[model samples]
Target: MIELKDVYKTLDGRKILQGLNLHIREGETYVIIGRSGTGKSVTLKNIIGLMKPDSGEVNIMGQCINNMGKEESYALRQKMGVLFQSGALINWLNVEENVALPLVEHQRHLSKSEVQSIVQHKLELVELEHAGKRMPSELSGGMKKRAGLARAIVGNPKIILYDEPTSGLDPVMSNQINDLIISMQEKLGVTSICVTHDMSSAYRIANRIGMIYEGQIIEEGTADQIKNSQNPIVKQFISGSTVGPLTQ
Candidate 1:
């Protein structure tokens, strides 16, 4: 459902993505694992139109986003959701309002009552049904992430992009988030692209896994295939090794 073809992106003479090509099919949970500063986040930003590629194409549902007009891009953006690494919640808004913000902005036809119901449903989907009135400061790290997930799906988006969903959480919480991600894909059939460094989370949630290094996807395979693959780069990364070609 999403394709990046020979994409190249740079900023102020620094190349962040270099001829990168990747694809995520519909209803698939694709996880991208890469070293810090290797452009994994940049790749996600390009897909979401938060960052533009210098040259090449980003196709979502067959529409080329690289060249879309402002109006067209906004319309296309309505079909996707993003959960940022920091949760990015409105610190001043309650959870319910935060979750409902997308619906309010994008779905003018819906009445407030209807939007509230949708927000409640989404919150429940993420297991935060009773936490709607809580503020960001009142939430734990995992709660904030779950609240972010609730907000992401409040609009019932066709695709969800998660940037480090497991970051800054305890092991149990990380696993819980992983299970929630898997459940969301199974229940809603949404295409998902997760950018993370957590190998265990990636293995748990990804139908297909890709390894990005030095601004390019170096390997792509099924989770089991990734585990068993003999490629030194993949092995070293998944094993959390300090020695490999990846360190060069």
Candidate 2:
């Protein structure tokens, strides 16, 4: 459902993505794992049109994002949802209101009641139905992430992009979030692309895993295939070995 071909991106004269190429199929969870500053999040921005590549093409459902008009971009974005790294919740807004913001902003034609209904349904899906009235600051890290997820899916998007979905939680909470991601994909049938440094989370949630190194996708396959990869870079990354090409 998503494809990046010969993509190159540079920020402030520093290259972030170099001839990066990736393909994500429908109804599957694809995880991109890489060291910090290796362009994992940059790849997502390119996919969503938040950042345009200096060269090459990014296509979502066969629509070239770099060439889209405002209306076309808006329509394309309507089909996708993003759960930001920090939850990106509006601290002042309560959970329900935060979840409803997408509908309020993009789907203004819906009545207040309809928007509430959709928000509540998403909250329930994330097992946070009772926490709707709570603010982001009042929720735990996991709860905030769940709330962010609720907001993402409230629009009923076809694709979900998760940025470091299990970043800051404890192991138990991380596992819970991973379960939620899996359940959401199974229940909603939405194509998912996740960028994370956590190998365990990546292994648990990804149907396929791609390793990004030096701004390019160097290895990609099923979880098992990635685990057994003979590439030194991929092995060093997944094994968490510091005595390798990657440096601090």
Candidate 3:
């Protein structure tokens, strides 16, 4: 389980997260939706310990990560995986090598062949086994995202964080990524937290959706509740309307 309690963050005198409280159960897909610059991506960074909240606690798997030492934090990180918006693949490395990078760095006990096998398995999981020898530039946008997904799960992490997974893709490619996410979750049963502005993707894959506005989670519920919510902010956001509390 992951929990954030009264989390507050500020950078250069600007508040990004304010008293953000959230709980995500294991083996569940939680999607966070918000307009641009609403601190959606910042929340993911805080969860992964890449950014520290100015106040409040970030607890992952019952451990207060904010107070953990470097060694402890490193150990905790091994249990989590992150898929950045751009895939963040190494330009010089082949697909398999990119996926195996995490395992090679963290699990030194595994021989080269073992790492390769693990890489192959993860690639197969993302339906990209044949593209293992291809570079990031050689793959299409969807393919690159799949490669990134393959790399994210190479270690069989308990939790996976996706930051704008469908950002720059067309609607078709976006849906394909959503289907892949749903399939992978069912196959592996990993806890997923996806931060995206794509409501269609959220409705398709998320078991529960949280709407963030002005640095706070103003509404959260099942997809149906979000769709029917009478809350002005929620309605406005779902409809993509420029007129609402958010625009003020």
- Count clashing residue pairs per candidate: 0, 0, 0
Compose the digit string of candidate 3's lDDT tens values, residues 1-248: 99999999887888889999889999999999988877888899888998888899999999999988999989989988999899999999999999999988889999999999899989988889899999898999999999999999999999999999998999999998999899878999999999988889999999999988878898999999899999998999899998988788
Candidate 2 TM-score versus the reference = 0.98
How many steric overlaps does candidate 3 have?
A: 0
Clashing pairs in 1: none
Task: Identify the superior model by lDDT, candidate 2 or candidate 3.
Answer: 2
TM-score of each: 0.97, 0.98, 0.98
For 9-77, candidate 1 gives per-residue lDDT tens digits of: 887889889989998999999999988888998998999999889998999999999878999999989
| C-alpha lDDT of all candidate models, in order | 0.92, 0.94, 0.91
Query: Against the correct fold, how does model 1 do in TM-score?
Result: 0.97
**Candidate 2: tens digits of C-alpha lDDT, residues 1-248:** 99999999999899999999999999999999988999999999999989999999999998888978889999999999999988999999999999999999999999999999999999999999999999898999999999999999999999999999998999999999999999999999999999999899999999999999989999999999999999988898899898877754
Model 3, stretches more than 4 Å misplaced?
none
Best by lDDT, which number? 2
**CA displacement after TM-score superposition, residue 193 of candidate 3 (Å):** 0.3
